[model samples]
Target: MKRLVFLLSALTAMSANAQGSKKIKEKDMPAFTQFTYTGNDRIYNDNPLKEGEFYTPVLQGCYPDPSITRKGNDYYLVNSSFAMVPGVPIFHSTDLVNWKQIGHVLDRPSQLKVEESRISGGIYAPDIKYNPNNDTFYMITTQIAGNMGNIVVKTQDPAKGWSDPVKLQFDGIDPSLFFDTDGKAYLVHNDAPPAGTEQYSGHRVIKMWDYDVKNDRVVPGSDRIIVNGGTDITQKPIWIEGPHLYKKDGRYYLMCAEGGTGDWHSEVIFVSDKPTGPFVPASNNPILTQRYFVKDRANKIDWTGHADLVDTPDGKYYAVFLGVRPNEKLRVNTGRETFMLPVDWSGQFPVFENGLVPLKAKIKMPKGATNQTGKNGFMPNGNFKFTDNFSDAKLDYRWIGMRNWRENFVVKGKNSVRINPLEANIKAKSPISGLFYRQQHATFTAETTLQYLPKSEKDLAGIVCYQSETFNYVLGLTKKGKDYYMVLERTEKGASKVIASEKINPGKSVKLKVAAQGDAYTFSYTADNSAYKNLGGTVSGDILSTDVAGGFTGSLIGLYATSGNDIQP
Candidate 1:
């Protein structure tokens, strides 16, 4: 609808700049300028794209543990940003169907300390590697918050930045970084099968270490466990985490991720001569899966695997993993994404082309490339539309921020962007003045255009559909006693309610939207940019879903602000 009438004329100019003549007080904040998202998903408009073709999760929403690396015709790709805040999210491609995000490998803040974790505790499954021996480019991961276990970072230029985060004595959770040809340097991970060697509940274990890479650490005792309970530990395999290690041709491959990322996830393989393994299983072991299919199939795509593997420069081979796409009641509010295929490695165990069945949102472009998704900036799949206009003060790596990225409450004007509210409010686990974005489709529609004037109800300033800090939904503009309302709260496990409120009519300019279709969701607002009104009538997105808000991440939307306002209208 003309982008909803240019998002209601930028919220009627932020409600006429909040009734000019200054004097709004009461902790007045909210400035926002423009924001708009749109994603008509009927399984991406019932699948279209027939030029050379392109589309696969290829990164859609809530990007998950992808990890890829090439560096010749340039490939690079990464995902897994657990506590958000500019954490890992690099991208760039040559023809992997046109990618390009180019930023964030723990951008600053002393290499991301996750200001307070939660929201699925910080980082997890990262793994990006490239080392023509020393041209450098490594990014290992696993920081379930605090103690920041297993880290690593480097960059002989992945786009000109990186380095800081070198803590890896090990303990485990998806580390990786192989590099051998003659120079040697291993370090695979996913541990916990040593002390007592418990054999049941999701028994993990894939160890390996020797690394040192000129003192990046991990050699003290040279650990070794390498695939102990995964592919047929006699049918007890489970959560054998995201471990990668490949060598191919001289033999040595390990690959992992066995059931336990939901719906029995997979991607298995093994074979070794020695990177640090006696390895073997791979009689076609999973090779990538959709768990025996049949969960109501059709436009489905369930949790696939946690892969990583690359090779093009004419060598072929491709993999990248992570998957998800539930909606229409199957639940999973867009988390775990990034998907890719192609890899037949000509026998000796390497498969995935068509990855064992049922996953195809069109593909078939890779011959000479050319799709440049949503044009130059890449990142845009199927039905899409985005608009920011925060007019650059640097911000757009898909606008993140959660456990940290404070940058003094944002500001950046000339076009608009103002936030400054923070008394810690999106249900504080800490750090939140808002500015998120990653609800990338499954029926979408966001919107924003603030310029507030709250002054009470502890103050609040619009839009947020967040999915953590205890499931979310807040739609703003506060001030309760002397008038001016809007409200619409929701939260779910941390408890909250107020599902509706009205009393508007103050100095106008507000536009806040939110729409969905999968699990329903509605909420609306508008102050004269023409009709909208509907606060809380269709709710139930099943608590923004991670199959009921349990979280690994997804569903962001934000642009919020707060003074600690506690929902009440």
Candidate 2:
């Protein structure tokens, strides 16, 4: 009877192993359960489109500073793809809700050096426009930190390919192009005030000058300061930037994103009879914003504006803007995600009544629009669960290393993944052992169990919130002599702030869980896998915009291990 029972148990174990192996394929992974992962929610409902639904981000991994334009019935969108190779990832959509990546605009290395650049310094916001006369597409980006911010690029046919970056001598960032009805092209850009001056030039005025397409330089034309800074209804200084010109109903609408492009700032519109504006704010300024009042709800997420407006083939107008999905639980990976909203015209000005919409499960395409489909190399839904008995030719797409990756980071021990510390300190250069994925949701929980052998006081291992090489947060285990410390390191500036640290008795295995409820996150550790205690809570930094940091990408959550000096596993 005992032998029979043992045989049953062994068979059960084998069955489990086989099932797990089959599910380890990258395609089989589930979507990351972040804010944007609305498993059963519908993208659009029966009601007239609401605020959050239209602009809720479909893709969660760091798509920011969106610039969108319409070509016939098709809508093409591009966002800042900083530091990642093949920058300026272009996406397409028939209905604004369901989006698919078509291709990247900057694919050549000569166009930009993306691999070696820092996270925030590579590319700024890019504007996409279709030349009506020639039916060509143009893209412009600001390469910050490289050439004293004097960088520009253009392409005649972005869908086919992009030309080498035609360097334009510009002083500031956020470069945009305006093609007037008179067959003349103009460049609208922002510039800082003169040296030692407190008043920045671009914030108070939108400078307009002729653009020389052949030479890729701003011509010596009469410069005009169309708009000036002033106090709005809120009586705050209105710093205007991101100027886009549209002529409608024989009136010129000069729309710009305002409020310093942070939380509480918004998309403000102004109108004038002429392209060069002595413009007046729309009676209803700040046409779109997420700043609403609801009791018991925290309005911690800020700066919900910076938009690209497009008109559909049917003459229906829409605006694509950026807003953060604040999870009460703080399990957010979708930071400043893209949202779509219908633009309604009241008399001569534009009005946006719909507020921010939360992400939903599936959204339908616009009528008569064809769906464009493509694979994202990695799984679209970034759920990172896989059983690796380790004998695979390559690591899973879900796994990413810290500074440097090496063969010794993982060891196949029978049918388990054995992770060891590559360096003692988290600050060491290229700690070969770390795995991460883009944070997809604003609210969710991530938990993992780890077994390790600590060899020194500098050894540490656990999960981390990686913004870049400089800014990040770590919640993991650190070793001191024979004891262990559950340490949380917040990296900002050039130093590490240990927010919470708890010592533990020597143990062979530990389970770690990090729960993000909204902007607040809590870390917990358990030795028995039964009851867990909260270590503490921390907030995610405001690092998504072009002001605080310049990049289109968002944050990532992953695993890490560090050895101060010796290699410990």
Query: What TM-score goes with each of the models?
Result: 0.36, 0.67
lDDT of 1 by residue, 291-335 (tens): 888988878888899888888888888888988888867888988
- Candidate 2 lDDT at 289 equals 66
Error of model 1, residue 206, in angstroms: 16
Q: What is the TM-score (0 to 1) of candidate 1?
A: 0.36
Task: Estimate, for each residue in 1-569, the C-alpha lDDT of model 2 and write its tens digit.
Answer: 66664554345334323322111221211111111112111222222333332223545556778889877766788887655445677876666655666567866546765433566567777788876755767888786633435455555555567767777765666778877667778777655444564354333556667787666678875566665553252354555667777878877877777777545667777787877766788766667665554423442344567787788888777777666554444323455566556666646866653544322332334455443222333223322232333345344433444323323344323233444444324443323445555566544566666665445565566776666666667777766666767777677653667777788752556777666644666777776666876775655544321233344456766666555422121
Per-candidate Cα RMSD to the true structure, in Å, reads 20.3, 10.4
**How large an RMSD does model 2 have?**
10.4
